[model samples]
Structure formats: C-alpha cells, structure tokens
Target: MSLFASFEKLLSSILLPIAEKIDKQVHLSAVKKGMVVLTPILLLGSMAYPLKALKNVFSDSAAVQEWFINNTYLIDLLIKFSLGFIAIYTVIAIAYFLSEGYKIYTVGAIALSLFSYLILTTSVNPDGSLDIRFFDSKGLFTAIFVAIASVEIYRFFTERKLVIRMPEGVPDFVSSSFELITPTAFIAVLFISIRYFVADFTGGLLVPEILMEVLAPVVGSLDNLWVVWFVIMLRLLFWFFGIHSAVLSPILSPIFVQYLSENIAAKTLAEELPHFVTGGTFSAFVNFTGSGVTLGLVIAMMIAKTQRYRKVGQVSLVPSLFGINEPVLFGAPIILNPILFIPFVLGGSLIGIFPLVLMKYGFLAKPFFDPPYLPLFFEGYLTAFDWKTPFVQLVQIMASFCVYYPFFRIMDKQEMIREAEVQAEKEKKSVFSKKDDELLDELGLDF
Candidate 1:
C-alpha cells in the first residue's frame, strides 16, 4: 500500500472511534448545546460596543454625538446583563441540559448548580451588596466545573432514592420540590465548606481567581499564532476523514468565548483588544465559506466540463455564500477523496491563516464583533468593522481557487470519463437494439 493509504487506515482505525466517543459524551454534549443556546445572547451582547462606536461615523454632527452620549447607558445595559453575567448564564444552561441527560429533576439541578456557582464565585461586600466580579468571562471555567459537579451530586442523591418523598395525593410540583431538599442542603454545605477552606488556604483568593491563575499558561497559549494554526489544521484533518468539526467544540468553545468576551470588554473601554484569536476569527477567516475552505472548489465545479459537477456547484452556491458547505463537501464528495485531500487540508489551512497573519502584523484589525452567518464578505467586514477585511477575504478566496484549481481539474476529468462510459453503456442497452433495427428493415415496412 502507498504511504497515504497507510496513514488513512491508521487515522480511521484510531481517530474515528475516539471522535465517536467524544461526540456522544454526555457532559461535552451538554457544553456544545449550552453554547448553542447562548449564541443569540452572545451576538446581541457583542453588538453593544460596535453600536456605541457608530457615533464616530457622524463626528461632524453634534446632535448625533449628544444623542449617543445620552443613550450610552442603554447600550451599556446590553453589555451589563449579557456579557457581564455570561458565566451565570453559561452555568444555568449547561446544568439544565446535563440534568435532562441524567433523567433527573431539571429545575432542581439548575437551582443547585446556580447556587453552587454563585456561592463559589461571589461574596457579600461590607456595604451589604453582592460583589460579582467573576460573573463574566473570568468565571467561565468555574461555571463549567460547578455546573458539572453540582448536577452530578444532584443525580447521585436522586439516583440513590435518598430524597424526601411526599405521600400520595400531593401535587407533583410540591413532591418534586420536596425531593430536592436533602441534596440541596448537602450541596450547599459541601460548597460552603470548600469555599471557606480555599479562602483560608490561599490567603483570600476565590475559586474563580484560583482557577484562572492555575490555568493561566494553558489559556495564554491559545493566543499564539502557531497554536491557532495547529488547531485549525487539526480540525481540517478531522474534516478530511468525514468527521464533524464540532467534536472539538467541547474543548475549544469556552476558551474562544472567554477570549471574545475579553475583546468586547476591551472595545467597550476603548482600549486595545488583548486577544488575537477568537471565535469570530475562526468563523470569519478559518472557516470562511465553511470548513476546508471549499467555496473555491464549488466555483471550480460551476465552470467544469461535467454536467453533474456544474449542477452541484450551482446548487451549493447560495448556501456556501452564507457559510454553509455540506452540500459542497458531500456533493463534490471531497471527504475521503484522495484526489482532493492535499488541497482540502494543506491548502485550506494556508488560506485560513493568511488573514490571521495580516492581523498579527497590524495590517488588519482583530475581531471584536461576532455577527453570525452573514454572507461572506459582509461577515468579514462586520467582524472587524474594517473596510480592508473584505479585501482580505477576497485574497483568501483567490488563494483557494489557485490551490484547488489543479486538483479540481484532475477530479473533473475523472468525472467526465466516468460520465462518458455510463452514457456509452446506456446507448448499448437502448430499447431498440441494432439487431431489432435490422429485423425491421428486413420486414420492409414503409413509413
């Protein structure tokens, strides 16, 4: 066997099963679902700073400036409730999904998880108000941990039938509420004790702070260009084998979200955004026109000699423009097609990272806004609010065309040959065969 065949077999034998397990894992599934639930909220929150920044467009108008100044608080409210308390929202969503998975009382599990997160991350100030400094992106890791842990605790007690069971004839809500009393008390005491223990042991650091500090290196490394490139490459490799890229979301989504929140915070403060990589970066650049950057392949197909390829291309065109490419991936059948593997993986990676490299060099601005699934060039412009962004996207598309052109020609030729042979076979099997024509001629029937 060839080297590529050996490598392909190795990946199928090893990675496919592992990917399947990750896809089905309950907690990860909950996290992916939770992020999906939060997407709309995140999009609304991300718009806050950009909308406020719009005042700059009318710098010549004092009235517009005054109006913006008067309504700054209204914009701030969007940020305050959405991104400001993002961790709280994340925990609640994750807990609800996870409890549903465990076949337990979802309401009780959600309440316990929220309580645990607040208890671990918040404090009462001397002014008798709550201090919620970690309620935003800073507490995401803690939120995830508390959500999983608290739900598991609720699941444990409920599974063991350790709850108070109200007698028959009681209302279902009443009975369910009573069922959670024991586990609630246990989780409350357990978390409170740990909170006190951590405070004493760490000289006043809270759980979220401690976690951020402990994981600082890992989080910080995500900003490196090489690291981001490696991740994009890995995702493309998984796509090459026909695996959905979302399998990596359980691990990467939270970090990307945290970075995005930080960027928006920086934008709101009118400061330089700290992170170079974000979820917006991936959506606008790396996965532009869908994973493996297959929009160019669609373009290639649209102009191909094969009628089937041209039809698939025309069908996939609109969806690809909106960043949907499953039609292209499966229709063009790039997945597991060795003829297209190099362009899909290596060429896609190179195209994906080109704009990021420009951002690193200060030619392009880093993404602070994360508008969802707007059409291609428009999405790029909205992401960074820069006029140059669309041009950069055009360059990436051109690069994609160049990379996929030669490989696409090879595939098109093979398709053409296959179509011709099939047509020839159909002609040979025609209803009026050559022998039938001869018999008709021998009968000398006049038309």
Candidate 2:
C-alpha cells in the first residue's frame, strides 16, 4: 500500500530472479570467485604504480633518486609477475574454481587450461623464444574464453568417465595425472587447431588481437562517460535491492583492468595515459568510500540528533575511511529504505559522473594504479599521481554531503519517529504492569 512497499515488491518480483541467475550461473560464479582469489596479488601489484610515481618525483635528487631507482626494481618485478600477467592468473584461477566444482583434479586441470590459453595466445620468436605479449591484461578476453572452454571440456570428459582409470594400487596424484591426459590433449588440440585456422583466416592476428579488434566498438562505448555512469547506476540499484553488486564485477572488471593496465604501461614507457575511465578511477573517485560514497552519509548520520543514526555513523566511520562500507550499508540498513534512495543512488551517480567532467576538461589526471583498502583521499592522490586529486576529492565529498543532506534529514526524522513509538510502547507496558500490581494488592491477591 505504501510507496516503499510497492517499490520493494517490484524489485523482489523482477530483479530478484535476475540477481539469483547471476549468482548461480556457472561461468559468472567461477569468474567471481576467481577474481576474489586474485584480489591480494592485484593489490600488491598496484603498489608498484605509486612507487613508480615516487621514483619519478625524486629525479632531481641524485642520491635520493638513486635510492628509489635501486629499490624500484622490486616493485617492478612484483608488477611483472602479478599484474603484468594478470590474464594468465585470471584464466588459471577461473579454471581452478570451475574444475573444483566438478570434482576434477583442480591443479592439473588448471595447468592444462593455462597451457591451452598460452597455445592460443602466445607467439614464437625466430630464435625459438616465447613472446608473452598476451599474458597480460591485453589478453583478458581470450583468457576468459579459454579458461571457460577448457574447464568445461575437461569437466565434460571427466564426468562421462572418458579418461583412463588407473588400477587401485596407483597413487591418487599419479592416477589423476594419467586420467587428465586425454582431456588435456583434446582441449590442447582443439585450441591449437583454432589457432591455425585464425592464423590462416585472419592474416596472422593472435586471438587477443582479433578479439580486441572485434570488441573495439564495445570498449570505446565502455570508455564513454554516459555508458560508464549507466553501469554505475545499475550497480547502485542492485545494491539498493540487497543484492551484492559485486556479482557484476567479473563482467566489468576485465574491461576496466585492461584499460588500467594500458594506462600503467603508458606511464611506464613515458607515454600518455590513454584511458580516461579505468578501474582505479572508478574505485578512487566514483565509489571513493564505497558505494554511495558513504563517508558523506556517515558524516550526516554522526551529526543527526537520532540515537540510532549517531550510533551507526560512529561504527561505520573508521571502516568507511578505508573504503569498506559494509558497516554503513548493512548498519544503516540502506537496502529497501526508500527515504534514503536519493542519497544512495543519486549521490553515487553524481560522484561517478563529476570526475568525468573534470577529466574531460583536463582538470584532473587520468588514474593509474590505486590500491584498494587504503584511506580515502590518499588513494585518490596515488591513483592520479597529482597533488590536485586530493583537493578534487575534498570537493566531491562536500558535493556528496550536499546531495545526501536532505535525504538524511528525512531519514533521521523517520528514525526518530520510530524510536518515539517504541519508547511509548515500553512506557505504556510499564504503566499497565504497575496498575495491575496495585489492583492485585487492593484485591488482597499480592502474589
């Protein structure tokens, strides 16, 4: 009957099924788990970019610069091993996750899947060396395809009992090794054949290159401010309905990571940062203190007169500063709270869109690598490698507060009203209990 009730009913009836589908879908679920597994390594790799910026800043001081220059190699090495071959890691992780679900020997399956991906993407040099250009983020599309395809094929063969079964005395490890041979060979051969066909049909372009060429239009649209904003709005909308918006990460992350890797590569090679939209940019600017940029909302609650608002704000403050806002998300219990809808959705959408305007006008540097879970403005500063970034973030915070203020006022008032009703109910019960005791005493039933 109420507007909030109607909106909630609509979301539950419509969006719930879609959210469930995303969570249960085989490829998507695997991709999500795979990304979660790689998060630590990616965060470590991101540290390299900020340090690289430091190394650049110290160029005027020989001794200081020399110290940084010498130490920079460690960071670069981490980047190369981790983020530099992110696609490879992603494929292996996805394959491992998918294979585990099928009760397959995960390690061997992942290994074969990785090999299959390499076969499709890697090129050979004239001197018999390997060119690993596609091992990095550039190969993301192909990596995903290979990982899923190879894992599915491996699972299919294993499930149908098509592999060699060793006798009872063989070690389990050795038995699995023998069992995987057929499926591995089949998957490898199939991709190798595709590689040959692609080479013949497409003028020698690698699978990654072919994918990049074909998806150029889509990537271009993804880079557009409007399109990026739409996607952000969708994530916020999902969050509003109590769905973990992170389910979409697998689909969006590769595209954003590829762009981010390109910008980092450009920075490393003394070239321009070509991408204006990237994962770091979105993380650092759009969702600065997590979805809804809840830092502003937290501040509003802290200053509100309502007791619950103050308590939730206090509890949420520290975590939100580090870009973790689950405290606020669940504590404020923003999901299905219609009074806070404007702030939850509109505030985030504005925060996400405003940075694009600044970047479009050349007021802010494009983002490079920004590590997750850092304190707020510091992350933004490291991301853009500019002193002005923190200042821009301050402005965004103020703007977000403005957007949240009115909605927060209404929500706070609503909370206070509910608290009043609860207090009145308690007081009424206490008075009734006292009257009953008095009545019992008067009636000589004092027990």
Point out where model 1 deviates above 4 Å: 427-432, 440-447
lDDT of 2 by residue, 218-267 (tens): 77787677888888888898999989888788787778777777877887
Strongest candidate by lDDT: 1
Q: Relative to the true structure, how large is the alpha-carbon lDDT of every model?
A: 0.90, 0.83
| Model 2 residue 323 lDDT score | 80
Query: Model 1: which ten-residue window has the lowest total lDDT?
Result: 429-438
TM-score of model number 1: 0.96
Compared with the true structure, model 2 gives a TM-score of: 0.90
lDDT, residue 137, model 1: 95
Cand. 2 Cα-lDDT: 0.83
